[model samples]
Target: MKGHRGSILDIAVVADGQNVISSGQDGTARLWDSAQGACIAVVDDSYSPINAIAVAEVGNAVNLGSPKETPSNREVGTEGKLVVLAREDKSLEGVSLHSRQSVFDFEGSDAFNCCTFISSVGVLAGGLDGNIIHVDITNPKSAVETVSWSETPVLSLVPFRDTYVASYGNGTCYIPLKGSEQVLQLTGPNRQPVFQVAAWKKLVYTCCRDGFIRKYEIPDLG
Candidate 1:
């Protein structure tokens, strides 16, 4: 909580919640001891402000490059995982948790606002331009897909079953189905930006700028 020199932008839990990883406006990503609230390690550094981050346990799901040196003994729950950084400089990068080295860096149309891993090898990075660019970790040079439901900057993303939910600055949220062009919208926020979203048991929840959290009971998608 106190190690970041600048404002903390986003955070993710790692090591099954024993530790927390945070991204800061100071351009650093740090790991922390959850119970002790102590800074564990400065995991990464970026030239641009890291706007968001997400961690995933991706054992053999994708190739997170080997570390050049022996990993520090203090690094706990860092192996066999990956961290995705959404930066303010129109770049989205993937880093190996164990190595803390960038595995892939891809260019985005605009500054990335948020990111999340939808599957073992599939990643979704939403940009300021409202473009949600999908990347395949195995082949990150090119975008697997990019969709823009609206021109407003994307605010958040949450992976749902077989599809993912995206929230936007314009107070719009959508669920885009895989292998199809159709999308479902989550309505209610009346022009207030939907800041974040989370999914559980087919239910979706949104945190809005209007100082209220909304929950949606989704119907059967099959």
Candidate 2:
């Protein structure tokens, strides 16, 4: 729990709420005991700073191909989930929760700033170059597809039903429809960068640099 040489970028609690996983700018992904504040395992070390982490219950959808890096010990158990790390090296890493084994390490168009699980078999990462890279976990080595609307860095990726709501450094919030490829912008009071997004029922909310939380009504996304 104390190994990161740089700032810890993100931390995710397990479904059981007893454990947490963290990614840091120090280039290590660590597992920790939430209650005891003990380090359980060092999940991976890429020698490159990690920017974000997301936990998803992937089950059998992950390919679990040849591990690129495996944990040194087995004290941390696998939890029928995978830990995805967004790294500054332009790579996205997936490691099994319990086994602490590498599931995959995928490089993207630019350093990834954020990532999220789109489905059981699919993952999405947004990069500094404004590209949203999609990965099929079951066929991870295949050519990855990208989506971009501008040249500004992507700051966040939030899953919303069948599509994803992404935010950019240029203060734009985009909701890209899955099939239609239609992009809808959520207008705010100003152009200050939208940092993150959350949705409840048919309403979408975004936090911005303008020191305001903006809300948008999505009548059809319910």
Candidate 3:
């Protein structure tokens, strides 16, 4: 809430809807009570700035391993949720919402610019080094899957059906198909960085720096 010393870059509301987590340029990730508009606690801190934050509720199917020790009173409510932060320190860290413990801390090839959860225990983080790393949080020793389309930094990732759509700093948005190495680039919108993306039903929307909101219709996922 009022504790961040710099600009807040991203914020995600917990599944319970009562709390919100924020990543800031001040190099800290904080948890806040939404209803009371108060800072509950500082979730994590990196010496460098954090660019994005995402929250996901891990279902029973995933094995996130046992906590190192008992959770404190402040961490009791976050048992099933994970707060993920994309940091300028070239790392992607997942923290347990309730226990305030580290689920996994991974270093990437470069600073992570954005991140999203493809599933409860599955995460995707895009880096400035032009790599998108996918992690299976259920398995601590799981091998990370890396995907790359260009040398440009990936700025956003939006889930679309079985696949996901990604936007880059080079002003390109693409969808990578399964069973093939090919990527389909979305047409229109000149070379302007697309910063945010969202989806509804069978349509996808993107907001670009060119001052325009672009919409695209996605075919049946089936």
Candidate 4:
């Protein structure tokens, strides 16, 4: 809680819910014991500000690279987890939670603002130049796909049922359909930046800088 030197950017709850990972403008990520509010470890350090981070339980999807030694007794519910960090230095990095090792480090077009896990081995990162980069954990040497539109800064990205939702600085929200070139638009906000997006059942919600929460309904995702 008191370890970071600058403003905290994003935090992700660990699988056990007792520990959390937080990234900050201080260019580091820290793992904290939620119940005790104690800083357990400095999980990651970078040269630029980390804008966002995501954590997911990756079960045998890809090799996380072996750690030099055994894990500490303090690390819990981190056996097969992966953490992805989006940094202002145009780097999208993956770290193994259990071993605390770097899995992969990728550079994007511009500063990455957000990232999310779509599957066991699939990862998506959105950058300030409106480019979305997709990487697979198995072979991170190259990107699976990269898409750009509108040229506005991508503010947020989230996984829905089948596809993923992305919000932009131009106040636009789009759902990039899975396995198809089709993209559905959520109309409403004009030009205010859409900061966050969430999905519940068939409803998709967007938090906009215009000071309103907008909801869109999608009955069928198939």
Candidate 5:
């Protein structure tokens, strides 16, 4: 599991198998063969310490919720992409995992803290200025920004189910993936800042700056 030479900022497990990709403050992304614990590929990004990494299946694939019994002969094409947040300029870089090449770069208002790719809406980047930049990877030239309360810097962005959960200085907010504009805000005691938020199964976990990892059950909204 140890791949990067420096601090590992983020690690993402591919949906296909036992392979994991890690990004670090070391400015490089390394692909690790989890079964063998060996580094397979190193994607160099100069000295721009990478803060986040996400991997998703490309093209028309089986829905994530499908049962294992479903027969699938889907061929994985080399069309997946990786989104990285560079600490130096607070910028976001899109690199194709299949090609291992830098595809495009998007500038944000301030230093970007983290980023994640939304399967339906493109790449979402969180910054120090409390703004979220949405970049359409298919058309990198046209990116959009969604303004937010400017008091706190966003540290992490995690998309779960159909909502995007964002963690900042003192709380976490869940934004709907579509439809009417609405936000579900969860505040912590004494306004403790949350550093990271992750969603798995029907639970959401938040790592707080107060050195506590809290888990919240996601209520059925169906």
Candidate 6:
């Protein structure tokens, strides 16, 4: 189900698998019905092109598991919050999907390219100015400077387990949760731009601008 005429910057499927949300270079974010492939809602933000989109389950903090329960026996519940990030006016803006309203807007000196939600830690943003900023959603007004990698414009960011995997034009860098040093760097094909990265099971996958999706086995950093 595809109807976007302009370039699709980013797309995300809802947790329920009933709808798909897409952000485009046309300065709009659209929610579409997955079954019929029809546009249901259009969020107009003409600040800049919406470069990335992320949907997360938000709800009251609760732990529903017993000590005797095994890893596979845990039950996952729903969180009500959905976070959407956009590249606006050389910065990043975040909004809530439930209210379809702006939650908070962050302005930086450089152009913000991408962002991702890291479970309970915070929101991580990568900038074209070679900086990675972490924002605590619990405190909407604070900008926490987590780590920085100079001379590289981080184009994509994906969180896996407790670490974050970011990609640039030169290669990909893996940042551990507790270490300041880079854990790993996997070079892309011939310096192609890494557009997106995803982590599933025990493997990490990268989609490059060269039109190839490559998968790598995630190493055990023990």
Better of 4 and 6 by TM-score: 4
Q: Which ranges in model 5 have alpha carbons more than 4 Å from their true place?
A: 1-3, 60-86, 200-202, 217-222
Candidate 6 or 2, higher lDDT: 2
Clashes of 2: 2
In candidate 2, what are the lDDT values of residues 12-61, reduced to their tens digit?
87776777888888899888877777787787887899899988888777
Off by over 4 Å in 2: 63-77
**Per-residue lDDT tens digits of candidate 3, residues 99-165?**
6677788888899999998887789999998899998876645446898887989999977787899
For model 1, how does the per-residue alpha-carbon lDDT over 1-222 read when each residue is reduced to its tens digit? 688888999999887787889999998999887877888778788778999998888788677778788865556788889999999999999988877778889999999999999988889999999999999887899999998999999999888998899999999999976677888898999989999998999799999999999999998776
- Runs off by more than 4 Å, candidate 1: 66-74
State the displacement of the C-alpha of residue 176, model 3, in Å, after optimal TM-score superposition.
Answer: 1.5
Q: Rate the local accuracy (lDDT) of all candidates.
A: 0.89, 0.82, 0.81, 0.89, 0.67, 0.67
Worst 10 residues of 6 by lDDT: 69-78
Q: Give the local distance difference test score of model 3.
A: 0.81
Residue 48 displacement in candidate 5 (angstroms): 1.2
**Alpha carbon lDDT of residue 94, candidate 3?**
82
**Candidate 3: Cα lDDT at 120:** 70
**Clashes by residue pair, model 2:** 77-98, 78-98
